[model samples]
Target: MDSRRAFLKKTLISGTGMALSGSLMPQSLLAASSKKITILHTNDMHSRIEPFPDDGGTFANMGGMARRATLISEIRAKEPNVLLLDAGDIFQGTPYFNFYGGELEFKLMSKMKYDAATLGNHDFDNGMDGLLGQLPNASFNFISSNYDFSDTLLHNQFSAYKIFNKGGIKIGVFGLGIELEGLVAKENYGNTKYLDPIAVSREMVQQLKNKKCDLIICLSHLGYSYQSQKIDDRKLAAQVNGIDLIIGGHTHTFLDHPEEIINKDGHKTLINQVGWSGLKLGKIDFAFGKKNEISYANSEPLAII
Candidate 1:
């Protein structure tokens, strides 16, 4: 939680006062002042509904959905404006998914109030038709900017981008998925055309900027990084100009802190990913000041113990 404290110190004192006058301000005054938005995210949660077995293996007895719900509830109870997000791979690991075909996962995420999520390679495991059958169960929006689903069964099931206004601060969020070729079976995705993530991101960011978004976040399932010339979150950060934070999935990398990279425009971009199976929750706090000035203040990666 305290990992990003240093960045907060740069915030003007007037902006810092929002933390003091949290809930007791007039509506108009609150709108005029700085606002805080908490972002909680998860990735590669491959249908581990229950905690791991109590055996002495790695992550033993760790990461259950109930515990994650409780933790999210506690945090939301304290923070007025919070966004819950998922990077992807929300299906196909445990027997729960094998039996239910993602109905349970969608029901649980709806109950937990997930704002949005992207697509991962394994999410296609059940195939397009299988995924369509479970769409009615999810209350949250599925966002994918690059994958052209017009020829598939999932057409119009997902939004390319969404804008959320939290405490008068406009936050723009979009999704980026990894290439499905060689990763997913052709029969599974059918005619879904995969567009270049970098190109799509460039367009989305410009649109968000045009809309005067105070913050821009990319929910990515392109993995953290790779040795070869594969497009990862880090590469996207370097290429994209306006993305402020990238909540990523795949490769199941457990990052203690977000990797900060300077973009082509020399603006800072953050990339954070929690390990698979819901062992931990990644939190990023965005505090907004006058004009479009913003600060990525704190990160509280809480373990679901």
Candidate 2:
């Protein structure tokens, strides 16, 4: 891996691109078919079926699945193409998880029409069989590009990437999970091989590019930036090219807006994470027109009130 500065310098010389990469707009949200798309995303929801009580605290009376559904419905009513995504940690936390063991979570997300989600360390709380047992409840796809579940019960439960067609725009989406060694118990994730995120990302990006996708998104449970050497969303962005945006979780960091980074190819990628507990829904509106023509890629934090 080259130093970021060195990579940036080579990119400049070879015209690998400084703003956008590979003959395409990096952060496109709209397609040229006179259609607009809305991306609705959440992360680390942690089974909060109901909002927090009005306990006179920071999250008082906020983050209920009902409110989130209403908001999503409203958006779908207005937008022609909308994609709802979650970045894992859909299990555990609240009493609902303790009582229902994630059935309700999957059912609710299915009812809300979630497009896809990734895996988080906590999703393995009850072990592989536990998660495999609950798979029948989720209507959406689970994508984990780096977690090799070939030897586990989850072998047939997920795919590495999914391509979406929205208003004529082909969007390539994949998932990446955090390393689970210190995070999850050994028995819980038995025989699930952890692949190198960077390598997997590189491969997935090439596949997506070959598929000729207009935009690429990563549903990541790898958290946001960390001060330590622990790999995070920032590292993913800096190392890989072709991923247009990253919807992240695991760290529970709240951002007023998405963070932008220049990738290995010198293209821009946006990283966004709404605070956990379903209190806030991340909304980004995209308009696509003309090849290689850049759009401002809207990033708005929509409160589910």
Candidate 3:
């Protein structure tokens, strides 16, 4: 147990390719002068309520909701300022969604105390009415900045963005979903207009900045990267400004650590995505200085064993 903790601590402190703009302060001074916030995230859960069976598979006996809950609880017990988030696809994969229709997933996420989550293409598998039916089970906020649900049954059901104040540090989180036209069946996402992600992201950033948020995060369901000119997380990070971190999903990209991309303003935007089926959890720690500026940041992807 001690060795495991040591391994996690080492991984967290020794994150590679982390982008920083300013000089880093001494550890002791930073600890005294800055406040630390730990962000824990997951993506593309796809209704894996229980861990994979031990059938000699790659992810066998891994990624159960119970284990995730225990791990999250342990972390929350140690860290006072912690945010738990998800980048969508919380529905449709296993038989659970077929039987429960996302009710179980939302209830479990609520049980795990998810702060916010976005929508994914697969999330619309059961259709708009299917998703709306399970909304009563979720306790957290569903943020979707780009997906316009004004003309659908889901109108006014989701927030464009949400601001959270954790220990006097203001954190703004918005969400962006993929273009669901061809991806999703037209009837599934009926009347839900897909807005331009880049444009919406810029607007969200400006609004969040105007609100004086210390940290800005985007819960993105737009896959990590793409070969063509698709607006994935990487493109969004490079094109949009003021988004400090983007927790992403889709394409099931397995990342050991967060990837850093320089935005239009030359500032660093970190993009992270864990593979599907709740196999891993992405964790990032940010330290804010007295002026509410991010002094340091690091990340690690925790394997759900």
Candidate 4:
């Protein structure tokens, strides 16, 4: 799970509804009408079917699946162009996972109408068999570029990327995962081969660009950062180009605000992560002006409460 407690504690002290004003807009699009896209996200929920206890804690009485579902439904009601996504670690925290082995998680997420989701290493805790066994319940797509599941049961079960058409706006999304070698138990992972996430992500992004996607998003489980040479989300953002946003998980980093880093092409890339256990839901509203320039950007981390 992400440091939801840490992020919530920081954000509450700083103030809520923090806004970013004055985004760069193309002169040609200044007079044109705008299109709105709302991106809603969560990560590392770990099958928390119920809200946390009311005991004194940062996430107490927060992060119930029902609350999240209600919030998502309300948002959809307000905005027709919305994308609901998850960054992974959807299994193995609550008793639901121990008893149902992720079936409940998949079923619920599917019912929530998730646009897409990536996989976390913990997703293999019950072994590849367990993960693959419950695939039928999830109606959304699983996009991953690094994992070569060809020899495993997940071969055709995942995609490297997907392009979504929303109100004439083309949004492309891909997924990247962490190295499983020594991190994941061999028996649990089976024959799944992990590749270089950065390289694969770059390639996928390039493909999406060639397809002329209006927006590109990367769903990553490669932890926020590390002292070692391990590649993290920040490193990926700096090394790659054309990625508009990186929604990350693993290491459960709760970011109070989205970090904007310059990518290889010198364009800004936004990276955000919500704390784990479904404690918070991340929402970003993008207003696209004429000529496809981003006119406004606002992000809010909604406490499950």
* Clashes per candidate, residues 3 or more apart or on different chains: 2, 5, 0, 4
Please write out the lDDT profile of model 4 over residues 1-305, one tens digit for every residue.
Answer: 34434433333343221223333454345324357788999899988877888899867787887778778989899787899999989999988789878877887787679999999989989998999898877889998889999988778889999999876678899999888878789998888888998789879988999998888999999998789888998888888988888999998888887888886578778889997999899988777767666666677888888
When 1 and 3 are scored with TM-score, the better candidate is 3
lDDT of 3 by residue, 20-44 (tens): 3333556566456548988999999
Candidates by lDDT, descending order? 3, 1, 2, 4
- Runs of candidate 3 exceeding 4 Å displacement: 1-33
Q: How close is candidate 2 to the true structure, as a TM-score?
A: 0.88
Best by lDDT: 3
Model 2: ten consecutive residues of lowest lDDT: 15-24
lDDT for position 202 in model 4: 77
lDDT of each: 0.85, 0.84, 0.87, 0.83
Q: Tell me the TM-score of each prediction against the true structure.
A: 0.88, 0.88, 0.91, 0.89
Off by over 4 Å in 4: 1-33
RMSD of each: 10.4, 12.7, 7.2, 7.8
Question: What 10-residue stretch in candidate 3 is worst by lDDT?
Answer: 7-16
Cα miss at 246, model 4 (Å)?
0.2
